[model samples]
Target: MTALSNRALNRALLGRQFLLARTDHTPLEAIGRLVALQAQEPNWPYVGLWSRIHGFTHSQLTTLLQDRKVVRSGLLRSTQHLAAADDFRRLRPLLQPVLDRTARSAYFARNSAGLDTASLVATGLELLAGAMTPRKELARRLAERHPGRDGRILAGEVELRAPLVHSPATGTWGSWGTRSAVSVTPAETWLGRPMAPVTAKDLIRRYLAAFGPAGTMDVQAWSGLTRPGSHR
Candidate 1:
């Protein structure tokens, strides 16, 4: 079969990732094309956009979040990320199990010993309903629900179970360091729409569009998703 050599494949990857050359795509359009951006802290995603867009500005992303067009949330690999608001509705549901797995791991499991799963999630949802809440405050409230438990750990677990987004204030272009007062809201309520059904095929198509001619392992690795009938 005819095939792209390694060099061609590398070029394709770079071009798809918007690294080969800067495009005039707006940050919003660029974000949709790229699917998601790493936002471990408040500022890294701005750097990602700055490198890829011509005349990229910090205000562009901040406006997007302020307008509810983009959101910062726990995404792939159970880590914080920035995704377009429309895309986040789908992406979070698709990766919900990944977040769940992280909570089920030994670290979280041990930290949350004796915490009843249903009560914990229900209480969190109830508390987060109808209002945006500071992360620390959410933890404090969850701690109140289960007096002996560490509020921070319980809040973290609630995050894994519920789709939450940090407020635009926290996501704004500020210091290069992590923002200290992050606030969160339920994704559905904040976006005013429920999550889209998980369609691994469509998500994979997005993956292949950005990084294609890739092997199953490549898709699995990049997305933190695995499928049956694949090589181990």
Candidate 2:
């Protein structure tokens, strides 16, 4: 077997990431090609798209969010990401273990001690159904139910437990890293469908294609899924 040189590897990775040259693909297409765009901040996904897509307009992506063609939600290591609305349905369920792990982390556990996770998620889903709810308002409502628990902490845990997406206005282009207030609704409600089931093998294949070949550690780090090799 011929060994691939470092330069060749770098080029391949660049091409796969759409960093080698701008492509004529639509913003939505580019988003699909990359699986998802890193979008912790409102403007980050716009920057990511502009660098990869030729003639990419800020409005083009903003429009996708406004039209509900795309969503900004917690994905890929339980951080915010931008993915096509249809794709989000497929991706969210497969990556849910990562979100579960995040919820069980020390910070959330400490703050939300004694909170019933299953109940919190169920209530959260109920609160968001058929309506866009502000984060503070949702938290306040939840605090009333959990008496003495921090509203923000309870709300944050629910975010990890259930599928949620930010409102279009909350995800629009902005200079700030994060908004002081965010409005969200259940993902299933916004997309008008349930989250689709996907397998670990499928998740690994998609990750390799979008992220290029990688070691087990790399896959785990990027996706927050432990023991990626076992997915083989």
Candidate 3:
């Protein structure tokens, strides 16, 4: 094995993360190696990937999402991310606790009070099983079921309660096109695969590979995963 100094390790980390210079990898490959691409805003990942991968095109990523090779799902600090289906499946489950706790927060308490979280998740999945549903539509349905409530809150809760993926068009450049609304798909339907299993050890290893020689707190800060001791 090659010995590396701390600065060398940091530089390598930055290089792999696309901080050093852009490369020629396809979006799929870049995302696979990076584990997940930050996607809080629909177009952020596009810009992010563009900065790192040469000749990156919007169509390439949209096609990947449409074809089920890549998926936009909740992860990495309980935010939206673009990741390979394989990575999303494994990572989503690991963030379950974080999702659950977020659901318990004042947001859900104030907006989705008296809501049966499990049933809400089930209904959201049922609504999204056949096709991608706009966040507006999903929220409308939830509000309709509950009556006298804000759908946006319900929509946000659905995200916390279920593993949801933003649809291709939503992530497509200019898809918003003067619209303030958002749309999303369920992760399972989007990827055509069941959720992947994850363990703390496995998550830690992947985190280290992607953002390594770091403290456990850094991992916790990135992935909402908590572990004792700083070293892997």
Candidate 4:
């Protein structure tokens, strides 16, 4: 193998990420090419898209969410992300370990020291059934099941433990009018489709296509995914 320089890798990332210049690709196409979009703040993906796609509009993404073409779920660092409905299934399962490990950090660990993750996830699904729920409401419901624990902790854990998608209306731009708003539904119910199945080798290929000429650490950092036999 040949050694690659940082500048070369940086340029490649910028090109693939569309930071080099806007592209004429359709919104969904652009999203698919990138593999996933950062969406910790629901609206940030809109901004991220705008910066990369030509003639981008909020409606494009919002419509995708509403139409069940795209979904916001826990993947890529256990953070909220927007991905094609088909991508969420494979991506979420691949990311579950990362999500769980991170959730075990200070945020959820303190308040949820003894909580059963499986039960918490079930409660979250029940609370979100037939409705979209913001994190606060989801957390509150989870807290209901585990009295005396912080709702925020429950919400965070539930998100990490289960397949959930941010609801369209709440994820729409300005939906909450500047408040921290997030409405979630189960991933399957939200997408009205099943998640995709992807293997580690396949994920590696996809990651490289989107963020390639990358070292193992770069790949790990971008997607919250890991596999054995990585290069330094």
Candidate 5:
């Protein structure tokens, strides 16, 4: 087989990601095509969309959030990402193992040590079940339940262990202005649907469609999960 040159690879990626040319796709459609947008910062997705989407406006993306058509959640690479609702439903479960692993990092381990993780997750869920709650509030409630434990750490662990998404309003463009709190709710509750089951193979195929011509290491880099088989 002929080897692809660097320019070829770069153009292919740009084309696949819609960076080669401005696209007419709506904000939701663009997000769906890309699978997910890197969104550690709440405003990054809007800037990302603006660069790829023709005539894109901040409100367009915000509207999708308001309508629950798109969600901001811990996903690929176990970081916050903006994913369309259906993609989030399908993708989050496939990435759960990675997210769980991230929750076990030294930072969380040292802070939440000696606490029952299952009980903590349950308590966190209960607190978030009624409504989207601020992270600090969840942490406070958990601290109240387990006095002297770091509520912030417990809350952080719950966030990592549980499939949760930031409240849409928190992710809306300009929503963070003058606001110190960020709200979150269970992904299932926000989506009104359970996480769809998917296998590693299925995830790889989807990853390829959005970021393919990629090697196994590339997929691993994007997903933060190792695949069992060899890659071409």
Candidate 6:
């Protein structure tokens, strides 16, 4: 086996990620090829695209979001990410175990003690159905249902447990400092599609195509997903 030096590996990643040089790919094309963009900061996706796509503009991404061609949701590493609608449908289900595990964090466990989580998620979903509700408002409504519990914590749990996506306005350019007012909706409702069934092997291959020649641990680190030994 030929050994690849650190520089060689770095360049390989850059080439795969389009960091070596910007490309003329459309925003949707770039986003799809990358699989997902780290977007917890709200503005990072725009920035990420700006660095990789030639002539990329904030409106380009905003339009894609408004058109439901792309979606901003909690994905890889259980953090916010911007994924093309098609990719999101496939990726979310494959990465659901990670999201489920995140919902079991200490904060949710302690805050929701003795509460029926299934019922809670159902109520939250019901409240958000057919409408994009701001996080604070969602929290308030959930709090009203379970008075005395932390509304913020309850809302956070709903997001972690449900396949929800943040409204486009929240991720649009110039919306960074106003994330608190962002709205959440069910991913399926927003995208008008069902979550696609995908295997760990499929995810692994996709991840490598975008950020690959990587080891199993690298994939796990990037995706917050565990792989069977055979997949590795």
Ranking by lDDT: 6, 2, 5, 1, 4, 3
Better of 2 and 4 by TM-score: 2
Point out the worst 10-residue segment of candidate 1 by lDDT.
223-232
Clashing pairs in 5: none
Q: Backbone clash tally for model 2?
A: 0
The stretch of ten residues in a row with the least summed lDDT in candidate 2 is: 174-183
Q: After the best TM-score superposition of candidate 3, give how far the Cα of residue 78 lies from its true spot, in angstroms.
A: 1.3
Q: What pairs collide in candidate 2? A: none
Per-model TM values vs. the true structure: 0.93, 0.94, 0.86, 0.86, 0.93, 0.94
What digit string (tens of lDDT, one per residue) describes model 4 on residues 1-232? 8877888888988999899999999989998888888876767888989999999998899899888888877788877688887878777876777888888888678888877777777777888874777788887777777789888878877777777777776556766563356677777776666656666677778888888876677777776767523311
lDDT of 3: 0.77
Predicted candidate 1 versus true structure: per-residue lDDT over 138-196, tens digit per residue: 89998887787788888888888889998887776774443556788898899999888
Q: Which ranges in model 1 have alpha carbons more than 4 Å from their true place? A: 175-178, 228-232
lDDT of 3 by residue, 1-232 (tens): 8878989988978976877988888888888878888876778878888888888887888888788787766777777788888988987887777777777889778977777878877887787765777788888887787788887787888887788877666666566562345677777766678887677787777778778767767878987755523213
- The candidate scoring highest on lDDT is 6
Give me the displacement of residue 137 in model 4, in angstroms.
Answer: 3.2
Report every candidate's CA lDDT: 0.84, 0.85, 0.77, 0.78, 0.84, 0.87
* Worst 10-residue lDDT window, candidate 3: 223-232
Model 2 residue 138 lDDT?
Answer: 88
The digit string of per-residue lDDT tens for model 6 on 160-218 reads: 88889988888787887788787999988887788885778888888899997899899
Stretches of model 2 off by over 4 angstroms after superposition: 175-178, 229-232
